[model samples]
Target: MSLSFHIGFNGQCKEAFEFYAEYLNGTIGTMLEFKDSPVAASVTPEWQHKIVHANIVIEQVELAGGDVNPEQYQKPQGFNILLGVKSESKVKSLFEKFAIGGEVVLPPQKTFFSPCYAIVVDRFGVPWKFSCGK
Candidate 1:
């Protein structure tokens, strides 16, 4: 079976996925809003515009996420989304994009295991580990 990760957001799933699509050269597919769901009536009007589900395809890999109920939302922890790229320049560019309004846990630099590597937590509170030239 193929495995895919489903992330939960407080309310920024749409924005985050859009940003990722742009920087990662991905295509966004199947964006559904809370109002579009069968249980739309159960969600508050304020949350109707929130994303219920979104899929972003990067290099044929699908990344999925959705906005969680406000009461149930929690910051992600313990794991990071690791991205393996083929070029150092691409990794640097992507790292810079992820650094906007984000925390840089580790700046891009040469590593023994790779040509370049970096770690950052994006504005959406998603941690990413980027490496290139493996």
Candidate 2:
């Protein structure tokens, strides 16, 4: 079976997905807004334009996310989405890009298991870890 991940955003799914698509060189296969979903009536007027669901494909990996109601929103913690890359330059580039306006937990450096490794939290509050095998 194929495995994938789904993230819950605090009303920033659209923007976050867009950013991820661009930075990761991924393609957005689907982006469904709340106003276009059958559950549109359940969300507040302000959230009508928010994203109900979004999916992107990055190197054959599928990533999905959606906006959650304010009452149900929670800051992401205790986990990180790890990306295994084959290029050191690419890993460093991504580390710099993802660190903008976000917290950098660990700067790019060589580790025992990888040529390069780092951790950063994106502006959308999603934690990410990069491991370069090259």
Candidate 3:
């Protein structure tokens, strides 16, 4: 079975997915606003425009996310999204792109296990680890 990553955003799901699509060279697969869901009437008018579900496809992997109510939203912790790339340049570029308006946990550097490696938390507060080479 294939695995995918799903994230919860605090009213920024659409913006975050759009950013990921551009930065990761991915395509938006599906986007559904809360207004389009069966529970639309239950959501506040302000939240109707919020994303109910969205998916981004990069290569063969799919990243999914949705907006969560502010009260239920929590800061991400404990784990990070690890992206393995084929080249150092790709890793570096991705790291730089993700670092824009975000925090850089670790700058791109060479390690015994990989040609390039970096850790960053994107503007949406999603932590990512990029590594190049097997």
Candidate 3: which stretches are off by over 4 Å? Answer: none
Runs in model 2 with CA error above 4 Å? Answer: none
Q: Deviation in angstroms for 105 in model 2?
A: 0.6
For residues 20-127, write the lDDT of model 1, one tens digit per residue.
Answer: 998888899989998999979989999999999899998888899999998999888999999999999988999999999999999999999989999999999899
Which lDDT tens digits does candidate 3 get at residues 1-134? 88998899989999998888888888998899999999799889999999999999988899999998999998788889988989989998998889999999999999898889999999898999999886
Candidate ordering by lDDT (highest first): 2, 1, 3
Which regions of candidate 1 deviate over 4 angstroms?
Answer: none
Among residues 3 or more apart in sequence or in different chains, the pairs in candidate 1 whose N, CA or C atoms overlap within 3 Å are none
lDDT of 3 at 100: 94
lDDT of 2 by residue, 24-122 (tens): 988998999999999999988999999998999999999999999989999899899999988889889999999999999999999988899999999
